[model samples]
Structures are given as C-alpha cells and as structure tokens.
Target: MRTTASFHSYATNHRLVFGDISSDPKTAIAKANTINGGKNGPFRAFIVVGKVFTKNNFEEVNGALQDGSVSVDLPMFFTDGEGLPEDSATNQTDVVDIAPNVTFLNQWGRLMTDDFIIQNATSGSNDRKTAPTDILITDKWPSNLPRLSKVGFAVPQTAERATNNDKTIDATSKDASPLYHFSGSESFWEREPFANEAGKHTRFIGLAPFGGKQRWHYAFTLKKDDTSTPVNATECPYLKEDKVEEEPLKRANEDDGDPMAKKPRIAPSDCFLCLSNPNLAAHLVVSIGQESYMAMAKGPLLPGHVMLIPIKHNPDFCTESRPSTNPRHRHPVRFVSPKLALELRKYQIALKQMHPGGVVFYEIAKAKGVHVHQQAVPIPQEKINNVENLREFFIKEAKECGFRMENNGELRDDQTNYFRIEFPNSDPIVIKLNRQNPKFDVTWPRKLLAQWFFGNKERGDWRNCSQTEAEETEAADKIKGDFETFDFTR
Candidate 1:
C-alpha cells in the first residue's frame, strides 16, 4: 500500500498517524489495551513504526532512515487465536508504504472505513520529442499564368494517417486535385515515407497538394558514410572454474609460524604471497618476483586477489606502477613492469588451475608508516566455512603446513583456548633482523608477556570489574608519571 500527494489532496501537507509497537513498555501496553477492546476498545489492534537502519539501534531522531521513502518494520506482539486479525485485514487494508511522486489513498482515515472505496489520481507526463524535422521549398511559374512560389509543411507521419485513400494522378492531367503517382511517373507528387521506412516499402502519402504538382521533395535515408552494419554476436566465451586435483601429502618443510609474519606485515597478511618479507627481496628487485609472490597467495584464497604495490609510496589507488612514455602523468617513483604484472597473472592462472579458489587483486597504496609493498589477497570462497567450523579446519591446515602449535588457551579471554602456530622457520630470523634494525621492532615479546599476565582473568573477576578499579587507576597514574619523565628524544 502506498500514498502520494494526489491521493491525499485535501491534507497532503499533514503527517499521518499509524498504530505500532512502542519503544516504551508502558506505551505498548496502553496501545495493546486500546486495540484489544478493553472498555469500548476494538477487539484487535497493532502498532507499526518506520525505522532507518544505521550504526545505532533504532532511535527516534538519529537512527537509520531511508531517504525519499519510508518502510515500516513489522512490529512484534503476543496474541491469542481470537485476537488475530484476518489475513486481508492485516495486509492491503492496514499496512502502508509511502514514497514521493506517487499517488496514494487520500483522506485515508475516512476512506478506509468505507465498505467499497475508490480513489482517483493522475500521474504526470513526460517531455515532448526534440528530433529535427526536414523542410522543402519549391518555385513554379505557370507557363500561361503569373509566376508563383509554393511553400508547404507536413509533420511526416501526422499527414499519412489523415489521408489513407489513394488514387493515381495522370502525369499529363494537371488536375486541380490531390493525386498519387507511381515511382516512375513523370508527374511528381510528394510521398512522405513512414517514419519507419516510410519511403522504401509499400508507399504511403501523408498529404498532397489538392491536385497540385510537387516541384521538390525532402526525404531521409541511411547516412552516406554508414557502411558498416552492426552485427550481433550470439556466440560468447564462457568461463568455468577449473577443477584441481588435490596434491598428495608431501609435507612441505614450511615452518608453522608465518614466514613473513615477523617481517613488516602488509595486507596479504595472512598466508599466500606476502610482499613485506625480505626473503622476497631478490624477487621484488626484479619484475618477475612480484608475480610469483601474488601467485603463492592465490591457491589458498581462491579467485586469487592480489595487488603488486610498488616499493615506493603511492597515495592513489590507480597509480600506474610503470612509467608512461607520455610524461605529463608519469609517476615520479619506481613502478612495477608490465612484464611483472603479466607474470603475476600467469602465477594467478597457475594457482587457479591447481587450487579450489578464484583470484582477485587489490592494491593498498595508503601506507601510513609500514614499508611499501603490494598485497595479494586470496579469497577462497569455496573453502570458506562457518565460524563454528573454522577453528578445526584452520588447525588441520596449520598442522599440515608443519606449523608448531603452542597452546596458549590458558592466556585467553572468555575461557576460549588459544593456539599459536609458530613459523619457527620464519619468526626467529625475523625477530633477529627486527632487533638488528629497530624499524621493525614490534611488540612480540611484550604482547606475549601481556597475554600471559592479564589476557585471562576469571569470569567472576571480569563480572566485578569495579573491584579492580582502584588498582587499575593506580597503575595508570604510575604509567602516566613514567611517561611524563621519559626522554623526549627517541
């Protein structure tokens, strides 16, 4: 059900009231009482309210709202069988959806009560045609009469329907009456072709000078230069996901910890090809390396999504990694080669051919402080499991990858167990390098310490957070003091 201005012509400017469930329990109870026929109340009633979906819960002033239109979210209620309204009563008769520029029930309150009601409304029309029209002029001097020029106009097809009757006019008759002539006839008569191929097929004339000769005529045809006729190709290539044969277990000597995890982590942050690893230094130095990197992540996340970011910072999403021959828009920083992008695509194809996932690519150019690197995200849509099933599958995969797991479940919140898979092959060396170069000095040790110390607190203690407020306050004050006295220079 909808309402427009035309339907409510008498009070189009007023707000309409609707019954609905209320935010307040008391108001809802009152509405329910009134509708349920308590002391002259109706036998049944319900309330509805329109809400906008937004970041917050449905709020009166700030919550979600759909622009230009309003949709009502059906209300909740508790009712006995006898109180249930008939399906028709609850449907077209009661619920209303409204939008702008549409006509709807006018004087709804009074009209709704009518046993059989009809409302009339009109919808507006569209703009008129702006196509150009052709004109023709002719000069004719009768041999024995005074010279005269004839000018006339007809709206092409508008005249055709007006005069359907056709009669041949003799070329030599020179009658003072309208007449039609065949194509080869010497006598000339204006033949306005159908707007739709009017002149070519069966001929039709819209208007003819009453038995007058046609000195000149205007007509439309295919443009002189239009030689190529558009051909619609019914045959198109179809793409189907390639099937992959699962590789036999050959336990990859890969480490359990993320190989590049200890390195500066960029997106493609999960497994697959990571751009931030120094192990990839040789590859990144050349164009081919970037593609190989993108390929690696493609298998695990299907429909491989990868972006080869240049080592240089580019703030734009579409920054070309390659230099353009034309310099006006040439990027100042180094870029990846087309060869590299092609190699990456090849790698993607290889992954797709052997993996269950598809490939997708996205580049992150907005690096705040992290090292510049392109990320390849593999989205294994097929491998995606519900959250409830994710843990077991991920664990199995980690084990298969030879990742050593250290159960840190005791150090988790919500009594949930934690499992850390160590890429022993990757982390120790990364940690060593990070220590040597302070730039990547992340909080691995501190994080572990924090987890061991406070990540897990009994549920009883968590429920009574205020009990530790004083201790937390003191700790914060001490930290603030320590920070205040620390050296300003790093």
Candidate 2:
C-alpha cells in the first residue's frame, strides 16, 4: 500500500513518461539523452522494485528516478532474525498461515502487518536507463515522485541480467552507498524489443504481481523536463545495538546542551576510567592490550573476578560512535563490529577457561553515559545447567528494584541505559534502565550473582569485599601471570 500510494502520486504528475509506451523501451529511453542527455530524463534511474501481492494491497509504486531518489542496493541478508533499526516486526497477527508446520498466534500486538512482498523489487530510477540496467517492479510505471516504504517482510524478485561473469550489481544507493551486491545466480538484461513487436498487440502500463500476466490501465501522454531528483528516501533514525549486521554506523555526540552552549566536557585526563587519570588505582591493573585492557575488580566479589574495559572511550556498543555524516540522525544505525565483538568474546572465553566451574559477565550501561566495563565473575560449575532458572528471578527482582525487565528473547538497540547479563552458556539478558529510575540500584545484578552463583549474599555488596592496596597489587600480579597463556592479547 505504501509503494502503491507513492506510484499513484508519481504517475499522476509524470503521466507522459509513464503512460506512453515505447515500441522499444530502449529507443524511447534513449530519447531521454537528447534532452540534457536525459540527465533528468524520462528514465529517472534504474531500480529493483519489490511487488507486494497481498489481498490487503494491490498497488505497485513502479519505477525509480536518478534524482538520487532511486535505490538499487540489496536490502541485505540477515541470519534468520536480528533486531535492526527500521526493521518492522514481520510476524503476522491478523492473518493466519495455513502451513502445517507453523500455527497461527491470532495475537494483537502489531497494529500494521503485510503479506506477499517481492523483496527484490526496486523503487528508484537510474541515469543510464538504456544500459543493461537493474529491474524495478514498483507499481506499473516509473515516474518522478517521492518513493514511500514501510518496514515489512517479503521475498524480493529481480531480472537475471548482468554485465560480466562475476554477475555483481552496482546498486549503490543515492541516499546510502552501501550494499554492493546480493548472491548472483540470476543475470539482469535489457527489456527485449517486445519480441517481434509485441507492443503492437497490446500495452502494459507495468506488470502486476498477481492474476497471471496482469497489468494496469494507462492515461494521456505528456512529456516535459523533470530534472528534479527523487525526494529523499525514507529516513529511519540510527539506533545502536550489541548485535548488528554489517551496516553503516554513526554518531556525533550525545550532547544535550544548546547549540551555542559551552558546556564543559569530561576529558581523559580527568576521567576515572582513563589510564591517564592521575588518581587511578595503578595497583589494580592486571594487563593491557591494543584496544582494551583487563583490571582486577575494584571490590572483589570473588578472588579472580575482573573487568574487561575498552582502552578508547567507547560505551561497549557502537564502534563508530565518534562522528556522523548525516546531521538529521543524531545516531547512525551501524554498530557492533564483528572484529571487535570476536575479540571481546575471546576475552570472555579466556575468563571461562580460568574458571572451570562457570562465569558470568555483566555490564551496566547507564542511560546518561559512562565508560563501559564487562565484569566477569565466577559461577559454580554445578549451577551452569541451571542458569535459565535465574530468568524469572531476575525479572521479579528487577521490578522491585524500580525498573522493568523485557526479554522478548533478543537484544534491544538501547541508545540510553541498559543492563546486559550473560549467564553461563546462555544468551545474554538485557533489562532497560529507564532514566525515570535515576535512583535505581546499579549494584543489584552483583547482589543476585553473589547470592545465586557465588553462594554468598554478603559478598554481593562490593564494599564488603574490599581489599587493601598491597593485597590487590599482589593479586593483580598473580592474575596477570596466571592468565598470560589464555589471554589473546599476550
């Protein structure tokens, strides 16, 4: 419906380019070059359009324009299910699936849902409409109008045409220069010459995805120069996440001050977490790596408990959280670099090896912002299989602690504050720490871990487990020596 509405708007304004049929789509499109070499010609741009053939929607927002409004990039592939900004929940509620394998939920959380979308459909146009260009199947015709889109799930389609054996599509988006290619089994080719003048028999405004070889009606033809770029593609706010695919990452700063305000910012020299801080407890330092470091727990819950901290001032989630190109988005969606994540996971593995029983890594992310630290504490080996049992306990305790716990069984893209807990051999648990609970107890997780895993509720309070400087220094040296063989940084 979104694509169809957009196509209707474009066809109404650019009737001449869309309504008129070319005995040869190529020759007629070639004519575009005659006008400013068709810089802003009838062939707006090349596009790969997805047609949604649901009974709920029948419209196709046809072709694309070169105004950088046309999009040719692959929508990207996912590993089954992953939370992403702009990604709409594809689970259907109102509709029922007749498949024997899966049962219908008949639930009602989703307000809007769609069925039968050709994810391969392109919505924008290209400059060289005459070349072996990408295939777009938005409504029936391509014209100069803004393209509209919504987050939904669909199986996309494309014409099997390509320029080389590599069979790659250079569908770099005007809005975003990402998605170089999708798997190339099918090749793309130019629209054939109606196969022996197929145009004389009948005309197709554009091919419809339903009713077996169907098309829509056309209107009057009037051509004029529409050198304007397609309106900007729909914009979705950038969100940071712990688990993300290979996408663009961005952010300037989380400065809430007025544009002109000269609010003082914390510097590494003064930050307690920074290695440069003069007041730092140097005796607690365990080992340092290129991008991260390990330090003994400030207040030891257990003798071997320690923290993995990023050397840079990153807040654990976003790698490119420093600068942003698009000002409209206060935060860019790309984050969770695989390389960095792999290293961090390796760090966790090292800790796990040191403790044959079990280990839990908990990171408290404050809504306001602070340097991130992943604290690894030991969990009894006998209790490893029972980690899932803690799920309900954590949830019940969270409410009493002044915050809510939401476990849709996936990691959320939290820009502000969230508490992440990875129990022994289980997927991480995340609880939102909304700013409303400013006085929320951050130490609550440690309390639970101490009681359930450490077998001592008293040690849950870090202050109770405090050690002297000399004792901490001696422990740190022993820890560095003990962990050297397992530490990847070494």
Candidate 3:
C-alpha cells in the first residue's frame, strides 16, 4: 500500500521590529524618549539588544514577537561585581557599561539594548588587548561594539536545521512549505494547520509580513489532548463571535423547495451572494463593509437555526483575515466604515443585553466543501436542557424574526433586524430613483429607494414572477448555476 503523508502547518502575521535607516541610533533615541514621556534630545545612554535562535546541539531557548517586536531574555553581557576600567594616561580608554538597560525598537524586531556597552578610553583604546578576556567577545582591537544593527542571529527555517546540531546555522534550510511563511490569506485568529511527522506532531508557524517581503517563523510542539478546554479573553482582540446582531434572512419564500438545496457562491465581480431564489430577499444584518454571517443557533447540525452573512466574514473576533481587493470586487466587509461597524456594535451590545447569560454560536459557512450564507444561531444554555425544546427554540425564533421555515422547520417570528433604506433626510441616491418615474407615487418611491439601496437587486424578479410557483421555479434555476459551497470541518 502506498502511504500518503500530510503535514499540518501553522501561519501567523507579525510586524518586524528592526531594519532600515528608520531604525538608526538617532531615530531610536527619539522613539525611546517619546516612550519614556520625555522630550526628544540627548539621553544619558541608548542601546539595543535581542535574542536569536541558532541551531545548536542543545536547544536552550525559543523566541517570539510581541506587539510588533521581538523578545529574548538571554544572559547579560557581563555579571555584576566586575570592576570598571581604571583611568589611564598613555592607554586611556573610556569603559561604558557592558550591559545597560536601554531597549531599542528596530524594523527587524525590538531589541533590549539596555545591558551592553561601548568601550571609550582616553588612552590608546586600540591597544586594549589588556581588556577582560573572559567575555564571549574579546577584542584584539577596538572594532566590535555591538549595536542594534550589528546584533542579530540567523533563524533557521527548516525543521532539521532548527532542531539539528551545527556550527554554521543555516536559517533558510527549512523546506519550501507554507509553514515557513505566514499565510496572507487567513486572519490572525485562525489557528495554523498542524500535521504529524514520524510519530511527532508539528505545527507550522509563520510571522506577519514586514518591510515589503520578509517574515518570521516558529515551531510549536503540539499537545496530544484533543478535548482541551477553550480559553476566552476579557479584553478580546476580536468581537464576541456569539453576539447576535440581526436574525437570518429567509432563503426562499414559501411555495419554493427546500432552501438548503441551493448552493452559496460569492461572486468575484460585485461581492454579492448570488442565490438560486431571486424571490427570496436577504436582509444583511451588517453593512457591506463589515463581516456578517447566517448560521444555525445551537450547532451547524441543527435544523431551523441559521445565520445571515457579511461578505468579509470572521469566525471569531480574536483573529480575522481581510484581503485587500479592488473596491469594485470588495466584499461588504469594512472595519473602519462608520456607517456599518458602529451599527453592528450596537446590535452585538443589544444581543448580549437581551439574551443575558445565553451562549451565542457562530461559524462561517465557507468551510472546506460547503457554500451557503454565513449564519449564526443564539442558543440559550437553558434551552438546550431538552432536545425537543432546543429544536422548538429555533423554530420559534425563526418565525418571530419573520419568514416561513420548512424541512422539519416552523416559523417563529415575522420581523427581523434587517436595515431598511430610510431617507436620512432625502439622500441623492433616492432622488435619482424618484426622478425616473412620473406616475410613480410618493410611497412607491420610498419603497423603491429602500429596496434598491438596502434590498437584493436579484430579488427584483419578485415583480416579474406572475405566479408564486413561477417565482420559485425561476429562483431554483438561478441558484444552481451561481452558488458556491462552504466547508466548516476545521
């Protein structure tokens, strides 16, 4: 039997800390002064230091980047109790501290330069062959003063090189795989892929891009525990994924076949979700710039529980990836747009308040193989106590939010939180629509504006479909050709 091997790799984005002229000594001093809350000028002393991982027979240390900087707690240059250089006339040499406490932020990475020193003497400093010889670096002359730019260890990229014993460390010997570089395609919160190799589980890790082309790398030894408890953060880097904003928009109107029968596909041209049923309207809870979703409430395996989606969707608030695309092809995912994110925040705050003590579940439908609207379901922990009760909760919620639920589903609500286009004092987009029709009444324009601005353009078929049956048929044909599937296995 031929055995196929698959290795899981991890990717992460981290900013570089030290590199280029911006990281010069003078520039570093200014930044340090600002961080210390002092005016920029001459300081008593300035330094830069860092920890680098080189391939050694005995692995003694590991490194990581924090807050766009590198961190390494290695041994100091020299221990305390060491005597300072004596003042000499003929061989005068100014001995600064071998280890000072100055930290330097560089483009390559942040350095802790506070523990080293520059040797300056009043005598013939070049003749300091008489200086301490026990140091790792002893000078025959005065040519080796380590600084931010001068200090760095080549990080090995290959697993063997990183884990092997060698004098001349080859940092770039790592295999040409995704694990060596960060995946620009994914968000920060998404865990890096992991795979098993020779009875050992290894996780591939990469850093965020810095200075145009370079990135960092790492290796995380994985634990065998499959049922590990989840961790939650207080001041989270992402929004609460469980927070409910707007209830899901219906997939298809009544008289149509099962909604799930249609596939979900994101279009490259407009970022609009082209569905099979045009008669069925989708009211997006979040704006085009914010990530949104439609999914089940208790679990994706559940029935009526569902989520409406945003084009730029995030599974969790901790780490999200948003690719920079052309404005025309961009999904309605925006983090900075005041018109969208602000309202989404309001919805999340409202959901947390309204469903006190309930757990909200979320998942992007864009998993590996499936394609459907990204939806989330809010399941009260108490509701899950009984299996039948849990199912009923989804049914009731779906109806209350408005829309007919089928396939062992029932309606619960009729009104959802979808935004309606209202004249925030008669915008121009509305004026243009009104001028196009003479016989069109005032109420018609208001409705048209709302539908045009906030409603699905494909849903315009609702006006042409004479019979309910015809509308459903037309929608079915539309969805089959355009939808894409989402895979949520991970």
Candidate 4:
C-alpha cells in the first residue's frame, strides 16, 4: 500500500520547487538554491515531477550527494514518472525513504503538504482514511478532470482513462475540487488558474522534459480559500469541445458502413452468472425480480434445489457495512444494502412457502469464481428437527477449520467472511474467516456441512447431479408456479 505523510502548520508563503531533475541534478540543485535566495531561502520542499536521475547521469547524483551541495534538512520528494527505474527493489514498495529528507513517491504515493495532497498517477488500492486536499499532483492527468481544448498533451491511451472519460466529475465535493493539478505530460502545456461558474478554482500545468526554451517555471501563492465553493465543467475556460468533428456525408446510394455495424455485447469476464451468454443455463431462470432472480440449481442437492442471485453483478453478499446503533452491540452491523437485504428476505420467504420442509441459505463472500448467490437447499420434514443439530455441527466444524464462529451480535460486517441463514426467521450464524491465508478455503465449511446433512459427499456439489434440460425446465416451471403471485420488484 502507498504511504502518506502530512506536513501540518506549513507556512503559506513557503515556496515549493517543482521541476524534472532526472537529466542534471547538479544544475537543478543550483537553480533551486538560487531560487531560494542562495541556500537559506524560504523554500520548504522540492517536488520533483519525474525521475531524479537518468541512466547516464548516475555519477552526477553521486557527486551532488558527495559534495554536500544540496541542503540535507530540506525535504525532497520525487515521483517516478513514465521513466521508472528498472531495479526491482524500487518497484516493490509504494514509498521508500532513501535519505534523511529525500523520499521517493512510487506511483500512487501521496505527500500531504499544508495546502495540497499531491498524488502520483497509479491505480492504487482503495484507502478511505485519507481526506481531500486543495491541490492534487499527478504524473498523468485523470481524464475525468476538466480537460483543456487547446492543450497539446497526448491523448491518454490507458483503459482507465477511457473509462474515466465516460464519468462526470463531481466538482462540488472536496475530493474532486483541487485548486491546482500539476502533471507531467508528453509535451509542455499550461492552463492559467481559472474558476468555474461556482467559483471553484484550478490551475493546470504540465511540464515537459527539463532544459527546453518554452515556458517551464510556475509560481503561485497558496490561498486560504482556494477550494471553498465548487464549480461545473461548463464554467471552465479550458473545457473540452462538446461536438464531434465534421465528417464527409455518405452518398445516399452507398450503404452507410453496414447499417447494423454495432458491436455485440459481451458478458463480464469475471462473472459466470450473467444472463448475457446464451450458452449458460440462464434459460432455467425460475423467477426474475428487479434486483435479483431465482434459478434451479445446476445440480440438485435435494428434489427442489435453487439459487438466488443478484441481477447486477455483486462480488459478494455483504458488499456494504455500517456502524450499528444498537446500545448492547460491541461490533459494527454488517449487512447487505437495503435493496439486497430486502430481496434476500423476500427470497427466503418465497422459498420457505414453497418448500415446507425447511430452507437452508448459505453464502461465501470470498473471491471465488462463484458469483454472489445464496443456495437454498430444501430439507425434508423428517430432517427439519435436526436443523438445530446442523447449526451446532457448523459451529464445531468452523472451530476445527480455525475459524472463530461469532454470534450475530458480536460479528462485525467487515470481519465476517461467511454466513448461513435458516429460513422461517432463524438467526444468522456469521463466521469470521481469514481471507489472507491461501490455505483457508472459504467453501469448505458449508460443503462439509452439506455433505453431512445429505449423507452423501457428492450431494454437496450441484454439478455432480447435473439435471437434464427437460428436468431443469420442469423445476423452473414448478418454482414459477409457486412464486408467480409473489412480489419481487424493487
């Protein structure tokens, strides 16, 4: 993970030296020193947008460090731009402190200045703790941010850039509002500080390689109210062009490049349950709802085994969590979203009404190939009294598997990795499993319990008892007959 260091109480008047010093560190240091009034200047830090040293200039850096010409007390933060070192050690960690005050901000690392939260351009892991800041520093500008129509920066080629370009920037939020965004592009570009319609200000500046005759140096004073009110994209002076470039009109006689030349839609590569693929058994859908749907299981664990899945692709059952207000609770409440929770409850009700024996709902929220789905296995009436015994068996099995079984009151949503809910208003049994351990199989506990319940190991797997197309259709028909009158809409 990328690390962040904040510098509080930094003087507003403190100057920040920004440039690419990879070609010549000696001259860069000399220029910085001169700009800071010959060594004792008011400069608080040096922000290097690109690499600090090139392949051929290693000796120059060595000489600069050996001569003690650079100030040791001043903080120097450098980001690895497009030109990253090939060494493995530098790429392994997010941030590395090479010297007392010299830090390398590996891609995506953040350096929190008094007035700005500077971040490099890299798709890092999600971190919710860091707060938004006034200015943002990145090597490559995010396409979601306001773009300059006249600027000559090369069009972004990354897939994320294309995806971000389709999203609207939320200018009102502090996380999106930045007074200045300094980046390093393929060419030199600059957009003078301008405010949008709502009075939010931003100055975009992109520096080319060092030593060009074109404009490179920029100086600005940090203001207290830099990001007070947010602005809209329409108000930005450098907003991108809205209309597409004109194209030659196609002749009426000629076919206009295949009237039906639209690309075919494809299912998500990660999700196997998406109904887009005709080859998949989506034809066996028993009942469809606004948020979720029910389908006959591919393999029957019982006479009427079925699965409930979300219409939209959800990675797992517990996708969101919130702090609980329960006065007696010691842990945060972990539950699905309101819509998903309601849908699950509805599915449980429908399944219980159809299967009088009993319904066992089990879910594993790990990174398994199995898309988020709850398995509803019907227990015969004779075996319904043994449900409590099965619950005890699960607890004992979980303990043997090194998982700490927690009561619903004690389990935090974030800590829960597995859970089982019995139909007819039974309490959910949450299990805290270690996600980091490779040997920790999330599907084992339920599979073992299912085997014990069914008395046959093969019964745990639905694929082992594959149903014929006609049988699947019959099952779907029966399920639909039972739930046709039920309300499953959002």
lDDT of 1 by residue, 1-490 (tens): 3245433332222111121222232343344444333332222212121111122332331121225123222222211112222345423331222222111221111111111111111112111111111111111211111112121223323343233221211111111111111111112333332111111111212222212253222122212122222232111111111100000011111222232312222233211233443223222121224323222221111122223443322222222434446676432333435654565456445434433343223222211113233333333344333223333443454455444443441222111111221211122111111112222212232222223223432211111122133443343344334323321211
Better of 2 and 4 by TM-score: 2
TM-score of each: 0.17, 0.43, 0.18, 0.40
Position 191, candidate 4: lDDT? 51
The alpha-carbon lDDT assigned to residue 438 of candidate 4 equals 23
Candidate achieving higher lDDT, 2 or 3? 2
- Predictions ranked by TM-score, top down? 2, 4, 3, 1
Residue-by-residue lDDT tens digits, candidate 4, 1-490: 2122222223344546465777666677667657655423445666666777776776556556656755444667778633445576477554667556677777645555433455544432221112234445554554444443444435435453344322112221223345666665545566545554224566667666566654445555556344454342234543333101001111111324442211112224323477654335665687777678888776567666788887765446655556669976554454567787788789888778777767777765532223578878777666787666776666676677666556562455342344444543466666543432223443464466556676745555333355656776787777667767663552
> What TM-score, to 2 decimals, does candidate 3 have?
0.18
- Best by the TM-score measure: 2
Model 2, backbone clash pairs (residues 3+ apart or across chains), number: 38
The Cα error of candidate 4 at residue 224, in Å, is 72
For each candidate, the alpha-carbon lDDT, in order, equals: 0.24, 0.42, 0.24, 0.55
Shift in Å, residue 424, candidate 3: 43
lDDT of 1 at 456: 30
**CA shift of 270, model 2, Å:** 2.8
Model 4: lDDT equals: 0.55
Best by lDDT: 4
Give the per-residue lDDT of model 2 (tens digit) for 1-490: 3366655444333221121211222332233234312223222222211211122221111122223232222121111111111112334222232122111112111111111111121223221111110121222222111122332212133332112111011121112211111111121211111110100111112322112222211222222121222243233222212111111111112335333222113445545467886656777777777667789986688778899877766544454444457788664454556666677788888888988777878887542244668898876666767877766667777677766555563555544356778766556667655444444555678878777766656677554565657777888888888898898886
- Model 3 CA lDDT for position 17: 25
